[model samples]
Target: MLDNYEDILTVNDLADMLKIGKNTAYQLINTGQIKSVKLGRIHRIPRQNVIDYIIEKSR
Candidate 1:
């Protein structure tokens, strides 16, 4: 489960939260299903975007 106060999440964190593989999480980001910002070599996903993705997919 994600912390309600978390503002940002990494690919690894996304994988764990979604119960999927790390590569799958990267694919979602690469495919634009989940929005992310690239900071140097690291990708950061906003917590709200993750929640939105879940809501969108559930619909």
Candidate 2:
């Protein structure tokens, strides 16, 4: 589904992909709804995590 995105995705990228705001993307990460790795001040989300989130939400 997210073939255009790389294996690792940035919060902004995720936001754009989901058509949501950056705050909402951050909320998803902070709430642990979408798994991510925090590196210093930056967050890296795996492409699979987003796919999983979509699939989970569909269920």
List the candidates' TM-scores in order: 0.91, 0.96
lDDT for 28 in candidate 2 is 99
Candidate 2 residue 49 C-alpha distance from true site, Å: 0.3
| Prediction 1 TM-score vs. true | 0.91
lDDT of each: 0.92, 0.97
- Model 1 ranges with Cα > 4 A deviation: none
lDDT of 2 by residue, 12-35 (tens): 999998999999999999999999
Candidate with best TM-score:
2
Model 2, TM vs. native: 0.96
> For each candidate, how many residue pairs have backbone atoms clashing (under 3 Å)?
0, 0
